[model samples]
Target: MRNPLDENKLEGHLRSVAAAGCQITLQDLEGYRPQTQPSTTSLEYESQYKLLVQRLVRSFSLEQLTQVLELYHLQPPPKPTKRKCARSIVEQEWNWPSLADVRRKKIDSEFSSQTFPLARHVSFLLLGKDGSQLRQLSLRHNVHVSFSDRPLSLKAEGLSGSLRLLEQDVKDFMAGITQETFALPVKRTISLASIQHISRTSGAFLETVDSQKLRIFYNKSHPHTLVLAKELIMQGLCQVTNLYI
Candidate 1:
């Protein structure tokens, strides 16, 4: 090779080498080999990236969206809040995560919390009029989580351990059941797009999905339900309409 390091050519040569390295790296990671020739400018790479994202967004499901956000450190747009306005006057304002991002963090937190080996069960007794007994609901289940691109499959017994109260006195009405066990299999499939709203009761909630209402829960120490809820919300697949915690 000619003396490419000569003063006149060194800078241009180095720039060319750096660009080639970047192109190779991008091509390797993205499986986007240049069609006609190697990319000679950053603009080419940028255009390719934009096109890739456009294609991805069209078919991105809840799980797909979450993966992309985490991979690129991207977040959903921030929701306008009064607290943000109050902090605008300060030089150093509080930097907070978006609602969707909050759920991602919650998944991690829930995972950590479960390792403590604390009590994993809580039983609630519903009372009727005049403080009379209605029914007792027990939250007892082993929690496991499995994630995929489109649907979230919950496999295990006792998935319906959670409860939702849409109308008053509904619990009282169900108190007449003489069933011996409330444990039911958690083998269920969830479609995020079909969910309208999510309501949680600290550890459990009922929500409407595909016009059908269902309940889910995270036992005392297990946070699989919470993690699932947050993931759904963060992905914009479901909205958290009510939370009683």
Candidate 2:
């Protein structure tokens, strides 16, 4: 080993040592790793996320959109109504466990106001003018509800337990029986797209699908015949589960 005093001399000595036993591969300037991002793919994903957010935002009412936006630390739009518009606790009406034919203990609608508790699930079971079993569906609102003795008028009461009024009536009562009432049509069939598995949360599968397909009977209706389409769909579900097992 020799002491090289000058910087150039020391560098020359170290280069000679490396030439003797170094196994390093020099890097290519062109082969340098780039720090560029996949801007295109990132933009595509961001676009999809924005679309999903738009859909979710659209589904909510103005009030809900506000709460959600605020929760996520986002700026919400100006609310038209300062009042809290949470879904008014629409009372849940009592439902029938069994159909009329199998009627063992049915809710009596006669003393409905008195017999049934002031505000319990009031199952309004009605019988069609015809002997055929007609089901009565529930129309929400009562007690503090705007009371009216006005009789629901529909000429063609087609199916039993159901009411079918003129299309104009359908548009008129669009807020009550025609407005916002939940009734399941008695369908002897079920579509896979229709029935949903009851969520562990709600414990009830909202039969929104195919429900729209139900024949809407307008006018004064009965509770008995106003059966839900789910009644028939449940039958199909049992059949399906039996086969799989």
Candidate 3:
């Protein structure tokens, strides 16, 4: 049997029930505005839902829930943040092949040539104080090189050295430093023409290449990379760093 109530009357009945049993207020259904930027309908829906949930408690049924939510218009899920893989970091950190190493080796292979030779790059197999091997550079050119002696250093993964961090870390660490452009073979390693082992009393020294953000950590008489870089900058070397490019 059809009841005599009109559609408006039925809506009013539903609204009254929702008002009593749930938190759908006139404000909830109609929304709000202020002096600032106009709020989106989505926000209004969220606010309404919050009000409804708090008001409804355990009384909200599936059908009632669907009716209220149909107007809300939910947003899509946010995109995921892509993290740099640590292996790539390790490879970049160490696998940086050096052109200078090649130049040095070439000099070693040949005899005296009147031509002034330059050290383009170097890669060292650093042995521990013990006879045991510690690390090996896959390559090192104008850039820094980090290599581990473990057989893993030569993997398709880009030099996977054993008991050592991955190459990606090395790369990322390098990424931290901004490279200065020189006329050289653009983007090539600078070789140390010579190494005179000069040992003396203490002052300061380079702790590590990557931890150079702290300005307070520099001591002049003591030689650290950042300090050396600072001195070089004073002497007209471009100082590029994670903090300053």
**lDDT for 4 (candidate 1):** 27
Inter-residue clash pairs, candidate 1: 156-186, 158-184
User: Which sections of candidate 2 miss by over 4 Å?
Assistant: 1-168, 178-222, 225-228
Runs of candidate 1 with Cα error greater than 4 angstroms are: 1-43, 67-245
Displacement of the residue 226 alpha carbon in candidate 3, Å: 5.0
lDDT of 3 by residue, 197-224 (tens): 1001111111222222212122222235
Question: Candidate 2, residues 200-221: lDDT per residue as tens digits?
Answer: 1112223342533433232234
- Position 85, candidate 2: lDDT: 17
TM-score of 1: 0.15
Candidate 3 residues lying further than 4 Å off, grouped into runs, are 1-74, 77-167, 178-223, 226-245
Per-prediction count of colliding residue pairs? 2, 34, 40
User: TM-score ranking from best to worst?
Assistant: 3, 2, 1
Better of 1 and 2 by TM-score: 2
